[model samples]
Target: MGLFSILNYLRLKVIVTFIRLIAKWQRRRLRAAQPGPNKKQISIPSRDPGRFIEGYLYTPPETPGSPANKKKPILVNWHGSGFVVPSLGLHDVYCARVARDSGINVLDVDYRKGPEAPFPAAVHDTEDVLKWVAGQGDQFDISRVVVSGFSAGGNLALVAASVLRSSFEELKLQIPMAIAIYPVVDITVEPAQKVVPKPIRPIPAFLARIFNDSYTPNPESRKDPRVSPALADPSSFPGTVVIVTCEGDTLAPESNALAERLKDGKRKVVHKFLEDVGHGFDDFCREGSKAWEQREAAYGLIVHTINEEFGHSG
Candidate 1:
């Protein structure tokens, strides 16, 4: 057995303990809080090239003072679940809030989860959405497109930006900007191995192992770019906004490192950080935690970050 395997075996007890700790500390999330109302779902064309593509389009609230259709920005959002889980109901509030605050059209892409679909499926779904959005210029009057995601979705957003670079060039498509919220980039580096080191957050090792077992037991597939965007060349990054919560995040350092990498590459980057919030703090807001207000604020930061990336105040 490998050293990691041995470490994992010894750490199994600790892993169980942490899971219980997280479960006990976290209130059972009954339902996600709904944001203010906005545009309802409208059908739109998907890209010609992709496997199992799906999306729900949302528009801004129709008000007497709403922005003109041709002038509103468009946000293409990807949901987070580490490419495995698709429990996006809770995450939808963020997008809805963005639409309300920014008055931008939101395209919530329902990308496939992995294990059955695995690495390439998630990123491929994102790229396909990119194409689909580009094709929707006449429909949504989408002059400015900003890509956004949180955690795993954030990583995919960055990867999509990279993959679309060539596609943008070929199709004469505008190079859309990206907003990555606590993104898990560098798939090549195991988060369990580094961020949540074995003894510290033992559950990550267990979960990652399970993820590996489910997605691709074969070690080779885990190395694929679709599996690990961190393996992608940072020197060639697209325009980005890296939102990180410092001091209490597993992904903060890596995200900060990525921002430096983007700056080094001479690409535009907005690096924002919240000092005291933990990882996924926004989504973790329970019924009556002090963090409820903080969590509520996260959506605003997300919208502002995306609009800022596109140089639009709205």
Candidate 2:
């Protein structure tokens, strides 16, 4: 064969190898889900259907390295399930770490998942949680408030932040800063080739459609600014730390692109890219594991950014 023919064959083999690697990573995640004593199965109190959100609160036994006890920063977290799966009752380790290591009080918001409670519901659920935490945490020293979530949940956090900022400007109260980890910024697919590329595209897109359909009723919700945050005119977003971690060249390019846009609009923003990590990695395991290491790195960057933006003592 000519030299060019051999080069083409080698390139194809490399692409195939990358696909096999992503498949292995997906399998490892599926296996990891079944083993644990951890899921911190705590009950959310006073289950009022209207006011009751289905998640737990984690307060550190000791607020390590805290500057003062004026008010513990409230970190309201939204769980991501492609906006379909229930908050799995599986992310307790993550809740605990956010509270303990970050020295911030954490509230895992169990926003109603899709189908029965579609687009505006998850967005509303998060907004309600913020109001509740602010009102209720008067006792816990909640002088400062912030919101964070993963994937779809991160999208909720941003939408909620946008809405909350509008509320605060109208009400004259403090608008909370936000941390969005691997957030689903733009649901409109960004020209396909911009992110997914020609290879390994099918299932992720298939899974995404399946996921979106389950939670959204009106197909128009897909274009609603509240439903797809990246579609919004981000003139009034809160101080945000946009975190991105990708594996096999996965999600960060979109995240990087979003960060670029946010910066262009002059929003208070920060962005970080960790090496060789994939989506939903934080909820996978604890320390000494590769996933745990990735989660911690992402988590630490968020903490520093929060502290820097809001300051340690709120």
Residue 111 displacement (Å), model 1: 1.5
Over 4 Å off in model 1, which ranges? 1-29, 42-52, 62-71, 141-143, 196-203, 287-290, 309-314
Q: What overall lDDT, based on C-alpha atoms, would model 2 receive against the true structure? A: 0.63
Tell me each candidate's TM-score.
0.77, 0.74
Report every candidate's CA lDDT: 0.62, 0.63
**Candidate 2 residue lDDT tens string, 1-314:** 58974564455445434544765576456543332222243344333564566677677555446545456666778876677665544456666665655666677777876554567777776666666665565545444667777878888877777745576443333445777777777665633343543222232654565556655545666787677777777676765546564553345566677667778656667777655556776665556887678777777777677667655543
Where in model 2 is the C-alpha error above 4 Å? 1-51, 63-69, 140-143, 168-173, 190-194, 197-203, 247-251, 265-267, 285-290, 310-314
Instruction: Give per-model CA RMSD.
Output: 5.9, 10.7
- Return the lDDT, model 1, position 188: 53
